[model samples]
Target: MPLSDLRFLALNAWLKRIFNADVTPTLISGDASFRRYFRVQHKDISYIVMDSPPELIKVLPFVNLANAYSDKGVDVPQVIEVNAEDGFLLLSDLGDIQLLSVLNSDNVYAYYRDALRLLDKVSLVIDNGESGLPLYDAAFVQLELDIFSDWLIKRHLVIELDEKTQNMLKTAFSFLIENVEAQPKVGMHRDYHSRNLMLQNEQLKVIDFQDAVLGPVTYDAVSLLRDCYVRWPDALVEQLMTQHFEQVKSSGQLDRGVSIATYTRWFDLMGLQRHIKAAGIFSRLKYRDDKPAYMADIPLTLEYIRDISARYPELEIFSAWIADSIIPAVEAKL
Candidate 1:
């Protein structure tokens, strides 16, 4: 028997035992990770069942963060049941309408404001002693940056770097790591963006939060404002950025003495770092994971890196190299 069929049979038996009745789960979708989601109707109530392979991905972090974030008033999915050894979880359904489906020019600012307000609550939930979230330290940042070079540049694009080009990347990466370390550390929903946010009954519910970490305050803000899946005008982004800037300051998450200029620089460079990592992940999803649908999003990621890197004099060489070498290679590949 195929592995998928065996897993489905195990899931079905597990569900039957839990409900005391035979329940069939309909497939919803698979996410970036090694997990599959199913919608099951039992006693007229719909629930989401997650099938995470225990060997590949653990179910404890999701359980921990779900409980923690829920306590802090974030509308995450409620955990109903769990079989930790078998990697099965039953959760309350948050519905199918993602925040991305409803956002438009007319309502983006208002909707994003509510989303940003949610971040305030999320930031307050800090890491406790041992069982807390992991730190997004300097080494972590460098490892992510390396994915761009390893997957996109070398594996997918098959580009060989000379000594000078390697040195340029080293210098640029160091600058980004410094920017990450200089910011105020807070609880970050590392992949906080439009697609992960769901709108049900006019309330925003966050999902895909298993990878939360303790990182820079500006990281989540930039992830939302300069999203990989969507783009907004510079004027609108600047307005939203300033709004978040004041929000973090008022909440005492950021120092009041920090100027808008300094905050904006942090936001821009932080976005550059994220885009660099995203481009590589997209490529890896194509070649390594056999999920090529993300390749279409790679162009926007590179465009963000190019445009943002050009704004800083220290990154001038890096920016020019991207525009001259990387962009064209990606264009040819696509």
Candidate 2:
């Protein structure tokens, strides 16, 4: 029998044991990680069964954060059952509608306002004691910056960086890291974007939050406003950014003295760091994991890098290089 079939049989047996009846789960989807999801209906209610391979991904962090965040009034899926020893979890289904699917020019501002309100609750959640979220410190920031250089520029694109080019990237990365250091740290949903947000019962529920971290206050905000998968007009994005700035300030998450100009710089640079990492991650997913669909998103990531980097004097050369060299390479290759 195929390994997948054997795994399915084992999962079925495990579910049967829990319910004391025959239970079959239909595959839903696999995410970017090493986990698979299945939809199971029992007692006329739908639940999501997360099948995270023990050897590949740990189940405890997700369980820990889900409970912690839910207690703080965040609309995360409730955990119903756990078989952590076997890397399986049964959770309340948040449904199939992603926030991205429903967003339009007409409703984006209103919808995004609600999403930003949810962030107030999310920012309140800090440490989870023994299962504390990791710090997104200098080392962490540098490592993520390296992924862009290693995967996208070197490995996938095969661009050998000479001495001057290497120095340019090093300086540019240092400036980005300084921007990260300038902001107040908060609980950040590292992948808090439209795709991971579910729209059920007219509310937004967060998912794919296992990688939450203690990072810049602007991280999640930039992730939502300057999303990788979708682009909003500059005016609309700026409006939402200012809205978030005021919301955070009023809630005391941000200092009242922080100027909108300073906050805008923080948001813009934080987004640049995220897009840099994402472009490389997309390449790594394509080449290492054989998931080529993510490659389609790389161009937008590059465009974001180009546009955002050009806005600052510090990153002018780096931005020019991207526009002059990197974008052409990517265009030709893709």
Candidate 3:
């Protein structure tokens, strides 16, 4: 039998032993990482089964973070069974309506308010300074920033950066990295966006949080506000920012004497770094991972970079290069 078939059979055998019932598992989704998820039906109940090939993906991080979030009263999946060797875990299903499909001008206010509340609640435990989640520090930030130049610029764009352009990127990246590292660090979801959140049991539940990191407080907020998947109006985003800042302040999470203006700047700059990283990753996913559909998001991500860069004088050269050179090249290819 093929390896995949063997793995499937083993997964079923394990499920049967755990539930004491014959179960048929249906594929649900796979992410950028090495893990795949399935929904298993056993005795009229639905459970999410995570299949992480132990050789390719480490299951311990997900397990540890899941326990930490669960203890903090966050709405996250409850672990049912874990097998580290085989890399299978049974979990409670958080239902299907993702925050992405339901968000609109009509109801975004209420939903975002709930999101900020959850963020504030998370603040309580994020700084335990002991969870041992990997630090998302300057090195990680630099690695992500380099992806744009390595994958997107070289492989996808098919253009070599001139010396001047290369220097501009170096300067731009250094500025972004410095700004990110200067912020208050905390336990961050790392990809807290609409799609990773589900409206389950009339409550907002977070999912896909295994890569939680000790990073900037604004990283997740930027992921949500300047989401690549969905766009929100600037006015509304600013309002939500105010709401989040107020909640953080009330929770004693905000730094003393940090004005809302400064916080907003941090949020915007953090988003620029993330957007740049995402642009490269999306391109890499298309070329290397055979996920071409991700290229659809590149234009929006670039738009974010262009808009944000235009606001900072230091990024003017980089911004001009993007508009004069990169944008046209990307448009021609697309």
Candidate 4:
């Protein structure tokens, strides 16, 4: 169904049921998925209406995790009403200021300190087996990597790789998966970056968390520090990572045998893996989903891949391929 029909019927029905008033929804934003969020004004109050087609998007994970995170006192939206069959929900509004819009050099340290605190609290909740989220296992990691080759390389870049380059990517993929599996498993807000976080009333409210997973401990941290949407200096990135390391250690989430050096390496390698995956997702969003705005972010994502891959011996060949072949092709397209 078109968004108009969805808004008129399913959304109206949910709003009437919840508020008993006629409410007109204003479109907020849409993510990479089929889900779209809208803002509704009712009786001098604001609420968010989530339209997630039941066939393409499931509302249960978001609902369940919202409850779980709320129980742990994490800042998140409150579900006031839910219509599972229609895949519509009425939630408490968390305002519109994304962390990205306000993050700058002057306040980055303060803002990131708060982000790390929230992350540590969430990690504690997961460590206690309270999250009940799915695992981001080796198979899942490899599947994410495959999108880079399928969408970014072949579909977007239109570059056909030779047998040797293909084999090198395979090797790099395997090595990255091994690195991911070596870390301590914890709760990951799979897309925990600037865009998904809301600064509401001086507190950060986490949103778009339906993709929460039991994954590598460093994944979300990397997603925050080495964000694809916004880039920070290397020195500031390292400093923030060190701050997270101390917090994780105090939370007792860091593995006993993993030293700070080992953890930082894991963070860096995981960042490269995620940046590669993100570049492909952005390309797929552009070519397949007709969302070209994401194309603007591919260069930074690839830069992350190129810079980090060159520093490791195991990824020497992969780094060379990116520098010599991938970067030039992507740059020319941009």
Give the per-residue lDDT of model 3 (tens digit) for 128-199. 334566788889999999999999999998888889888889999999998888888777888888999999
Instruction: Name the best candidate (by lDDT).
Output: 1
Q: Is candidate 1 or candidate 4 better by lDDT?
A: 1
Give a tens-digit lDDT track for model 2, residues 1-334.
2457776778888899988988779999889877889999888989899999888888988888897888889999899999888899999999999999999999999988889889998887776646568999999999999999999999888999999999999999999999999999989889999999999999899999888899999999999999999999999999999999999999988999999999999999999999999999999888888888998899999999999999999999999999999899988988
lDDT of 2: 0.91
lDDT of 4 by residue, 1-334 (tens): 3557744576777687777877888887888988888999987989998999889887877788888778788889999888888888889999999999999899998898789788976664453234467788999999999999999999988889889888899999999999999988988888888898999988999998888888999999999999998889999989999988888887788856678899888999999999999999999999888899999999899888989998899998898888888889998998
Q: What TM-score do all the candidates reach, one by one?
A: 0.97, 0.97, 0.95, 0.95
Error of model 4, residue 197, in angstroms: 1.0
Cα-based RMSD of candidate 1? 1.4
lDDT of each: 0.93, 0.91, 0.85, 0.87
| Candidate 3 segments whose C-alpha is farther than 4 A from its true place | 1-4, 127-131
Candidate that beats the other on lDDT, 3 or 4, i.e. the better one? 4
TM-score of 3: 0.95
Q: Please, what are the lDDT tens digits per residue for candidate 1 over residues 228-280?
A: 99999999999999999999999999999999999999999999999999999
TM-score-superior candidate, 2 or 4: 2
Q: What is the lDDT of candidate 3?
A: 0.85
Clashes in candidate 2: how many? 0
